[model samples]
Target: MRYIFILTVLLLSFNTFSQPISWVEQTSGLTTQLTSVSVVNDNNAWICGYAGRVLRTTNGGANWVSVNAAPIPLTLDLHSIFAIDSMTALVAGSGSSSFLFRTSNGGANWTQVFTETGGFINSVQMGNAFAGFMMGDPVGGRWSLWGTTNAGLTWDSTNFYLPQAGTEAGWNNAFFFEVTSGVWFGTNNTRVYKSLTLVNWTTQPTTGQVNSYAIWFNTPLTGFTGGTALLMTTNSGLTWVSPASPLPGTANLSGITGFGSQWVVTRQASAIYLSPDNGATWSTSYTAPAGNFRHIAKSRANNLIYYGVRSNGGISKGTLLVGIEPVSNIVPDKFELKQNYPNPFNPNTTIEFSIAKNSIVKLAVYDALGREVNSLLNSELKAGEYSINFSAADLPSGTYFYKLSTGDFVQTKKMILVK
Candidate 1:
């Protein structure tokens, strides 16, 4: 899993912030129900759920440190966690059965590595520190692949090959890995499986998408998902589209992290949207007081965003600005397209627009089923402020859609290459 098409230049500093964004409530003295969360930045973070709870936070969340699973007790239910930083990590569980634990001092002590009883272990991913991957749900009906280069000691659910149908399972935190674009999950039938090289596998069929229950990828062709509806696959999942519904009442989505361009979606027990363009549109950043949210973790060291409120068991932390504010000498009143800076991009990303008067211009790119791969610009500028330097190398990851026209002032935005 090694594909590198580098070139990342993002130096935008206008500072902007607005939108229904607000979430701050962290103090998990445990009430149960935290399904999952793993953030190794912005101060370190880690969380699990139900009975075998295992919370942690280095600083970002203020203060939270309750880690003790000793011989794996407390009844077991830790959905999944793979923190790989603030001192190594890896966790997995599922009530009446299933297990896998590992720690290197951070959690004080843990070391079960693997276990099996009936079925259960919905997600756990680790791309370095000795490779990693674990996803489960269908024991006999297939769908349960494990692999660990070494970190977790030893594991290898037998090479690979997942196709069994009949009642496939998976969707707790809906597993998704990326060491170059390799694992992905979300199945309860609606389908959505992929594998760049986690042992060759591929599936697609979330047509209208339902039961997709959380699957994320900000690169590897940009992805996002949630059960019953709400889906978007810039090509990584093969083909999937239907994005709007961050929480119009509820299509029943559950946990989805963020990266490329901020994101945080969770709508099972209702609201918690928040997308700074990477998801088209979304607002109500956080709103869950009753009982159902499973996961949402992002903190690539500073972005900071964590939440998992299984109804009262609570756990929250926030820091989402949506950047766009700093303005002293701003300029531009009419024509604008700006929405493509650092967006799920890899291999260069930067595109700004603001031509209020000048004429003849084109700039094109589309592919997420729209065709028209690349065009860049067509020319006759001179308006005020501009910024363009888009590059995808040769394209491969997925999701693309850019249009700018000039005369009547058309617009279109969405970019992701991830290769």
Candidate 2:
């Protein structure tokens, strides 16, 4: 059975093999599609889209302010953006007359960094505050790549690697920048370009012919590149192995990003897939909140994951009630038993409970006939939030009940297991 779940502040939650994550919507005050997002931190981010659109959030998306680009034409589609801080960022627009804009005064002023006629910019990335790179569609049989050592003040266009002989171009949000000066970009050539030392670049073919739209690397040695299916690499991009697609065989992956050690992949408006063990196995954690999910960003300061939608004109914040992060920092004021996530679960789920004061806690699950099937926990507790995993690998799928008892507080919640 398909399972859909939601979480509350009480902290009672669960996760079967198929657990749903809660996505909270953020108002962008615009309806245009936000195609790119660069999360500077938990409280600062920059989002860009069509019509020279740029949105900045400094207070963790509670409030978003618009950064205007008046001199630049509004009809151009700003498909790629890189935010260095609250006041400084770079946005690239794709069209017949592609242009790149930079702002240093928090949008009070804007400057045109570079422009190319009859070209389209697909991705832009910065390795440091003063160094960055940009890629455009093939021009004269060579993909356009430019480097800048002095921020956007000057760009060097003659220092590109040997060009391949094809109409090789890049997809939106297909670029990745590693801290060790590694750069990777997916292309319509069904190949991935990797620059181990940033001085030279090499292209490696993927297992499938579909264009890779998104790419992520947990470490320089481990990464996942997705197009029609998922390809994983353990020894960097030297080799890749095809993993089972998280969605059905027909769905194409739209975007992928990393949240701490966990990974997330989106399939447009259909679903969001989560991988707890790097790129090994994935499960459906939630459906797309709005429109089609184009990209997702995670804040390095607080590790908050944010989703940007295509044509939805808004962004959404999400929280994981299972996997690594079970709850935020808000502690409960009283002992309570909350609901389990993905109540109609499959082979696995999570159980969360809170204690207001230190007490002996006991948790056990029983079958529909009141027979105990599993003892999840029996521990000396603290006045904090705690969660435990409950895997029904050996139990038959059916109705099950879980009870929590601690001092005078005793409560039970019913869950369904459908294998």
Candidate 3:
């Protein structure tokens, strides 16, 4: 009786610790295909879609109010949006008469800041409250790009000259901007245009003949682009390669966003993929029964929270809970490494440990032949309980060993990858 009770309690504890992470659906109350979503903070976000529809949620999506009826025409197709705050935002519409609109009073009124006759506005990004850039398809043999320094009150087209490739065009929300490192945007010509000074541009070829739609960089050197194909670069866009583990679906990828080493990508179909260790491995975190997820956004106030917008007015929220998480702030009395959860994990598992004092730690994995297969951690940490996620997606099924060492305490444990 005593042995059975202990086993039951252990099983229950394991089940509680390994709860699956997922995306919960939210009500957006519209049927238009939402093209973009921008999250300003934990409590504020904005979504824009076809029919010039704009929805603002000040209370973290508890309710969304339509803010584009009077000044903005119903025939406009808003492609991208950037929210500066709960009240200030800019939306760009594409197609024959591409236009950019700005709202300062939370959407009661809007001002048309910029418009072009034939070009298409693909993206609008703000470095802050004042400085921003708008990217568009090429026109008159040049990429239709503009920059605004005084918020969205005015735009300048004289500072940069980006010549476009023959018949090349930009995709919606397909650019990345870092204030200190400049900007990058992908195109349909199997090229990615980058500008360090936002004045002179250079183009780099991806791995294959691909239509690059989603571009994101953790740093200037390491980045990923997805559209017709998923490609990654580690040498500042000098070269690109495919990841070892292929993504699950065949649909084209539409959006990519990340916080630290965690990444979330949306497909043009009904699925969203998540990677806990950068792009080393991926899993389908959520899938809708109908429609497709067009773009994804991460909250500026919280790194864990993410919002994914569907084509047919659906909103899904997901939290990244499978990374290196600090479990306790209380200092531990001794150093120890607990066995990993789900001993025979397929490709993902959690490893928990405790540190007695501030120390440099190294946790690594080795294959049966004693070859170092992966390096999970090599950093200094304070005395506390920590949980780390380990992914073996690229490795073959085999018995492996993981070692945790801090200060003079060292321990090794065995785990199995069944697939």
Give the candidate order by descending lDDT: 3, 2, 1
Clashing pairs in 2: 14-341, 15-349, 15-350, 16-348, 33-311
Cα lDDT tens digits, model 1, 145-259, are 8888988777888867686688778777787787887888888788878888878887888877657888888778878875756778787878887765444555577787777
TM-score of 2: 0.72
Root-mean-square deviation (CA) per prediction: 19.3, 12.8, 14.5
| Residue 45 lDDT, candidate 2, scale 0-100 | 85
Q: After superposition, how far is residue 322 of candidate 2 from its true place, in Å?
A: 9.8
The estimated TM-scores of all candidates read: 0.31, 0.72, 0.73
Give the higher-lDDT candidate: 2 or 3. Answer: 3
Instruction: At residue 364, give the lDDT of candidate 1.
Output: 73
After superposing candidate 1 on the true structure, give the runs of residues whose Cα lies further than 4 Å from its correct spot: 1-37, 45-80, 83-88, 92-99, 107-110, 117-120, 124-135, 139-165, 175-186, 191-207, 210-241, 244-255, 258-274, 281-297, 300-419
| Cα TM-score of candidate 1 | 0.31
lDDT of 2 by residue, 190-273 (tens): 788888665688877886655888888877777888787788877888887775444343466677776444677776664666
Q: What is the C-alpha lDDT of each candidate?
A: 0.71, 0.72, 0.78
